[model samples]
Target: MSAPDPVRCAVIGTKTIAGQHLPVLQTLPEAEVAALCDIDAEALGETSRRFGIERTFTSVEDLQTWGEFDAVYVLVSVLAVAEVSERFIRAGIPTFLEKPPGLYSSDTERLAEAARETGTTAMVGFNRRFYTCLQAGREALLDTGDVVSVTVHADEDAGDKWFGEKFPPEVSMRWAYANSIHALDLLRYLGGEVAKVTSVVRKRRLPKPDSFSALLEYESGAVGRAIADHFGPKGSSHWYEARTASAVLTSQARSSPGDRLSSCTLERHGREPVRFGLTGLDRRLKPGFPGESRAFLRAVQTGEPVSFPAPTLDDAVRTMKMIDEITGAEEWAPKPAS
Candidate 1:
């Protein structure tokens, strides 16, 4: 008997994030990167050639029609996320949209409704929840039931060009939406769903919004603090810490392009402050893009669950709502200068 055909997949948005998606799809034994699409023809051709993808298109609509893949990885900009996602959903294709899901709750809700009506699998890409350290932390905390507070610090050297050309003044406010949503989602993943958030945003150094700090009150009576910054010196670091009554977990490492990392520290609380020391795991925790792609393929083939702790469309919408609250809060208004 002939073997079953591999799952045909196409990647939309051939940017840096799309670069991550392409490799992941190629690694999946049950999936193949059948097509690639990008507004930039140069990028489209480059990625297609590099990845050995034969079909390429400059428009998602064209790609969708020609490629006819079972699923599409939507990795475009925040502004384009919802529209592109809705298009595929209406076309009856499952989609794995990169994080934030959409620019606003309304857009996300629209996509969510479409997914439900079409009965297509829609998963949001919040990859942090898939990390080995995070997975261990989740299991440890759940077993102990002693987590009280969690603190996280995430800093990105967005570089001058990122703030200047990537985000203009009019749309700069979305920096918080596009970047910090992952950290905010992490709070919900680790602590429990956030009940309320008090947040403050600041713009420093480069123009546009760049920094924010928030306090999250979780439904389980746990409190967490999250800080995200993109305006920092080059070679900056990403640090994350989770503490419970019985243990404390920490990771400090430099973030590479695409915010990937090399190493991290995991600590267990002891009588005097014993350090567990630094250990090196696979630089690509969760295998970054490839791991997620494999998980999606598995879910499709065997009816197994996706490996990552992904946000549903509804969960992503709610996270966007929380971001809106933080960004639009009256309490976060700037004080009068002396």
Candidate 2:
């Protein structure tokens, strides 16, 4: 009998996250980074050479039509994600789209519809749920009484141009969508679906609004609060904590030298706080990325179901919708300078 065909995979963008994705794909025995696509030739060249990829395409159409990849990792900006993802989904390629699928709800819904119609499997890159501490936290919450309130603190000194030049200028201010999206995904993952939100935004020192805090009410009668700020003078960082009738979960605020850390700690009411140790998943071994990638591939390969903790497409849409509402409300806007 012939050996099963290898899973050919392509990376759709060469940005920072792609930096994360490419390394991981290399570790999967069943997967290969067959193609690299990016509008920037220089970035494409760098990635192609680093990964030893022979095929590189500057256009999405060309890459989608010419590549032999069975799956694609869509790691481009949220604005461009829908367009590129739709192309791959329509082509019958399984996809692992980066989180917060698109800048708007309509776009993400359209992408979801395309995936459904074409029978293409898709997964969102909400990586935090896979963190060891968080996984244990969820297990702890199962027997604990209903969650009452949650507080998430995420601060990153994302230097100038932290997200790179590809992101649309308007949405670049602060990490309301970029960084907090992860926490927002976690909030829903732990506390339950958010039913309403009231928020306020501030731009203390940065050119764009760089700080925000919100109050969230969940469908399960739980309450949540979240803060995302980029005004720190120190290096990048992140922290999150959740409170329930039985326990509390916390995460240290620390990011890698150049990369943001997404770690957490879960503190039970009467027990010690459980810390998800530094994810030793080397960028070389592609630990976290490969872990999620392999899980997705296994689900596709075996027809088994893959479950996610938070920020599913639907959950992300709900979070984005809440952000839109908070950002648009006159009461939530910053006051005019005196």
TM-score to native of every candidate shown: 0.82, 0.82
Off by over 4 Å in 1: 1-5, 157-163, 168-171, 202-211, 234-237, 253-266, 269-287, 303-308, 329-338
Model 2: how far is 116 from its true place, Å? 3.0
TM-score of model 1 vs. true structure: 0.82
Error of 2 at 104 (Å): 2.3
1-338 per-residue lDDT for model 1 (tens digits): 76556778778888788776665566556787778888989988888888888888899868866757778888887777888989988877778888767665667889999988987778888766665545654665565555678776656666554646876432344555566666666666767677888988777865555677888887878888878777767534445666677676655334434433222344455544333321222243233355456556666666544443666787787777766665552233221233
- Backbone clashes, each candidate: 1, 4
lDDT for residue 235 in candidate 2, whole number 0-100:
48
In order, what lDDT does every prediction score?
0.67, 0.68
Determine which window of 10 residues in candidate 1 has minimal summed lDDT. 273-282
lDDT of 2 by residue, 242-277 (tens): 777777666654543433334456666677666655
User: What are the runs in model 2 whose C-alpha is more than 4 Å off?
Assistant: 1-5, 141-143, 157-159, 162-168, 206-209, 253-263, 269-273, 278-287, 303-306, 329-338
